[model samples]
Target chain A: MITFDKTTKTYDGGVTAVKGVDFTVEKGEIVVLLGPSGCGKTTLLRMVNRLESISDGKIMIDGEDSMSLDSIELRRKIGYVIQSNGLFPNMTIEENVMIVPDLLGWSKKDKKERFKKLMNMISMDSEKFGKRYPHELSGGQQQRIGVIRALAADPPVMLMDEPFGALDPIIREKIQDEFLQIQKEVKKTILFVSHDIDEAIRMADKIVLLRGGELMQYDTPSEMLVRPKSEFVREFFGKDRAIKSLSLHTIRELQDIIGLAEFDEGITDTITINVNHDLRNTLSMLLNQEADQVIVVDDEGNKLGAITIDIVQKYLHFEIKAKPTLVEKG
Target chain B: MDKWLKFLEINAPRIFDLTIEHAILVGAAILVALLIGVPLGIYLTTNDYLAETVLQIASVMLTIPSIALFGVMIPIFSIVNLGIGFVPAFVALVLYAQLPIIRNTYTAIRNVDPEMRDAAIGLGMKPIQRLFRVEIPNAFPVIMAGIRTAVVINIGIGVIAAYIGAGGLGVLITQGITRGDNYLIITGSVAVAILAMIADGFLMWIQKRYTPKSIAN
Candidate 1:
């Protein structure tokens, strides 16, 4: 766990970039620091690795005072990804991903194994891309190398500062989904910083909302959507709170009410969605197909349940309570 | 044109010796300047105040006329009992070469993408590691360009070194001027120009060869 106890960052000019902020990131959780520019979100994320010094209070990592640890050693244990991919231009993609491991003195055989595993994790052909330099790859591919480079040493904590900010919308969505899949397997404690509300909602296990170096709200995405503490956060979530909330839920969340709808043979032609599909996509499918309900299937294409518009509406209206179980299981 | 060819044929042996001397003078001076200037340039990047002072001094050196700088070097070398001959000429040429070499080194290192440095540091690379692995490799092309400029300029200024008794292609030109022989002067001037072109082409090839293929674009 990483704990911030009244951490404050005051610049030489007496401008407090992060003011007495406190929070704890549980292991295997992805906590996002969401805010506008100059709100200290980046500062807070950087402070954890000692890239930005804190003027007051303390940061404890795994219950040890972080300041007492060697800054280099501290940083080595925490993976860091930045807005620009930051791959060394002179090095090839394989060498880039293996940098941290190489530094940590992993044997040649071990480095080779990790290199193949990381490339395969991203579905990149290790043999073909391994020899190619960062400039030779597209922006999204470079970012994948950037992300995997951080994971090269198997560091328990990962810090990403707008890792996908530079990509086009389609590439960004694709990478975000790919990253989510990787996160499920790695389960590293992650502190992600992003200004995009939709990105924050989609990736964060918990969102720490800040404005002008002050914490406005610290809650799960669903809770924040349902009960915004201040007008700033509510406004920040934008005007379409209900529709946005649908994205926070998946079709499987209402599985308890699934058996109520009969899996009739006549309705076999209805649109089929995976159980893990988000409620927003399910609703869009319903409207597009002009059907009141849709068949949901498991990964094996076995019909698991039927999701109706009535359940989606009830869940959106808070008529049904969603117990916060692990979403990665699906 | 016939006179020039006749002059080259008659003075071929002497011209050959003088050409060797010219190459040695320029080559040695550039070698010394690179040894001193490259590190100084790298050092300047880390120390802003020193960079400003050193670069200012180098720029000032460039503004002094080559003849005047050679004259200045004569007295300094004579005081150290190494007067005239190749020592003073070599010293003058080295001083002249410093501006381009140092400036290029400083600018190349400074121009390295700041984001790359941040990424390097964030990944726990030591200051020295980042300098060698990231900064130097990226700055290499510009640094090589600087060296090329310095060498070419040194070649031109090296002709003036003959006045200080350093034998070179300039010897033919000086002798031709004294004897009022335009053909001898033309031969010396043409040889020096050709030599400069050859050196520039060689360094350009080296620069292209050494630049990483990924960043060649």
Candidate 2:
């Protein structure tokens, strides 16, 4: 676990970037630091790896003070991914992924195995891409390599500073989904920094909202959506609170309302929503199909239950209470 | 044409000897310049004030006329008991080659993307590792280009080395002028021009070969 105790950062000219901020990131959780520019979200993420020095307060990693360790050694122990992908253009893809491992003096056999495994994890053809330079790959492909390079050494804590910020919208969404899948298998403690609210809500196990270098709210996505502590947060989350909140929930959360479905004796519609689909997508499908109720199916096309507009509305209005399952396991 | 042929015949053996001397003088000067200038250029990148001061001195050195610079070197070498010979000319040529080599090295190192440097540090590379593994490879092509320019310029300045009794193609030109022979001057000037072109071509090939393929474009 990484703990920040009253951490503060003041620039050379007395500009305070992070003002005695405190938080704890538990293992196997993805915590996002969400804020506008200059709110110190980046600064906070960087401080964990000693990229940015804390002017005051202590940062502890697993009970050991981070400042007490060698800065280079500390950084290597934590994975770091930046927006620009940061792949050395002079190195091949395989060599890039092996940077950290090679730095720690991994045996040649060990490095080769790790390289192949990481390439496979990203679904990249190791043989074809191994010798290719970083510039040879597309932007999204390069970023994927960037992520696995961090994970290659299997660092417990991963720090990502807007890793997908540079990609176009379509590519960004695709990469995020792929990353979410990877995160499920790896289960490393992650400290993610992003300015996009949708991205924060989509990926974060917990979101730490910041404004003007101050912690506005630190809560789960559902909690932030349902109970925004301040008006500034509500505005920051934008006016789409209800729609955004729907993304945090999957159809399985409304299992209690499954029995409310009235099976009409001779009616069959080919359209079916998957049980794994988020509520936002299910709702959109409901409206687009002009159906009052839709059958929810499992991966094998087994009809599990049906979701109706009334049920969705009831959940949205808080008429029904369900425990928020923040992460969906595949 | 006959005059030219007669000149080559009478002076062919002497011309051959002078050509070897010219090559040695310019080649040695450039070798020394590179040994000093490239590292100095790299050092300058880390120290802004030092970079500015050193670059200014090099630029000033460049502005001084080559012949006058040769004259200045003569007195300095004579003070050291070297007198007027290859040493003075070689020293002068090396000084003249510094501006291109140093400027190019400094500029090339500076041109490395800051993001790449950040990535290097973030990945836990030592400062020295980052310089050799990251900075040097990226800065190489530009640095080589600088050396190319310096060598070509040095070949030309080497002809002036003959005035101080440092023999080269310049011997023919100096002797031709003293004897008022246009044929001898033309032959000498042509040989030097061809030599410069050949040296430039050779360095260009080396530059292309050493450039990292990823950043070749």
Candidate 3:
């Protein structure tokens, strides 16, 4: 666990890069630091590794002060990956991955073993890639090396700074999915930084939205998107806010909310979709199941109201004046 | 034989030996300089507070006139009598040679991408390990080029120590002038130039060998 307690950094002449940041990266969770350019998300992430020292307050890893450890040792203990996948141009892939273990004075056998494990984890064939210099690999391949190099030591803490920002969309999505799977297996505490809100929504267990180095919002991506604390966040999440909301809920979640569909009483009546799912996906589910109407259920899986095309349209266009209704709670 | 003929005849073998002697001195100096200078160069690159200071000091030491500089070290150690004659000259050459190799090593390592530095650090390299494993190895080509330049220059200068009984081809040149023997001068001067060319070729070979083959394209 890591916590920033009123951590602030003010440069000379008082340009505060970060101002009183207070957040915690929970264990085994991907906490994304997200914001627009110059929002200081990158600075906040760098502070964790002490790449930039804080001006005031404290950052604690577990219960220990982050400043207490030697900077080099502290950096070595946490994995860091950056946007460009900054590989040492002079080194081969295997040498790049083994950089840390070599630094730690691991024996030749240990270095080789770690390299093999990391390459396997990143899906790079050690035999093909191990001897190839960084220049030899393509863009996506190099990024994998960047990621696995950080993971070589298998540290519990990982810091990534816009790791997916440079790749093409297809490659970007693949790496993101791969990272998600890797995170599940390794379960390291991760602080991922990006300006892409959709990525934050997809990746972060906790999303931290920063503006001018000030903490604007820190919450789950779903909450942050639906209930932005400021106009800045709403604008930053931008025009596709509704689509991003849907991404979190999923087609399965909205299966019950498909606009208006006429229902028929088939003796006992019929419905599709489980009672427990997000209301945002209600429309798509109705269209796919080819059902005229689906029964919306309450907490105990009891039928509350049936959703047809018209009803779901009402739910879509109409803001629930009472409260944000959970479809499962309908 | 006539006066000039006898002079050349008597000193021909001596001239050949002097060339070999000066070649060995410069070669030994570069080796010893590289041993001390490379690590210092690494340190200078990673550590900024002293980099400019150390670099300037080395540059200043190298720029002073060689005869005047060697004259200064002669009294400091009382090494004139202790079989330290050639060794002390070797030491001066090493010190003089350091400015180029050390500066280039520092430049090469410092010029390495900061992203690469961050990546190495991110990947768990402690500073010392990164210096030897990544930084030093990456900087070698440029550093070797600097060393090559220094070697040729040092070999050219190394013969000058003969002015003070540090026997080499310079002894023949200085002696020939004092005794009115042009043959000695020609013989002595040829030895120095040939040694410089050969030393330069060797340095070029070393530089080429270490230069990454992949850079050719």
TM-scores for chain A over all candidates: 0.90, 0.91, 0.80
Better of 1 and 2 by lDDT: 1
Our model 1 lands, by Cα RMSD against the true structure, at: 3.7
How far out, in Å, is residue A21 in model 2?
Answer: 0.7
- Rank candidates, lDDT, best first: 1, 2, 3
Instruction: Give me the candidate number with maximum lDDT.
Output: 1
Shift of residue B114 alpha carbon in model 3, Å = 1.5
Give fnat of each prediction, in order. Answer: 0.66, 0.70, 0.52
Write model 2 residue lDDT over A1-330, tens digit each, in one string: 889899999999999999988899899999999998989999999888888988999999988999999999998889989999999887889888999998899999999999998888889998999999998899999999999988989998899999999999999998999999999999999999999998999999999999988999999998887677788887788767777889887888766544436545356654678888888877887778765457888899978766787777777655223333222210
Clashing pairs in 2: none
Q: Model 1: per-residue lDDT, tens digit, B67-110?
A: 99888888888888877889999988899999999999999999
Q: Give each model's clash number.
A: 0, 0, 17
**Candidate 3 lDDT, tens digit per residue, A77-135?**
89999999988766778877877777778999988888888888888899888988888
Off by over 4 Å in 1: A258-269, A288-293, A304-308, A320-330, B1-6
Docking class of 3: acceptable
DockQ, cand. 2: 0.78
Q: RMSD to native for every prediction?
A: 3.7, 3.7, 7.4
Worst 10 residues of 3 chain B by lDDT: B208-217
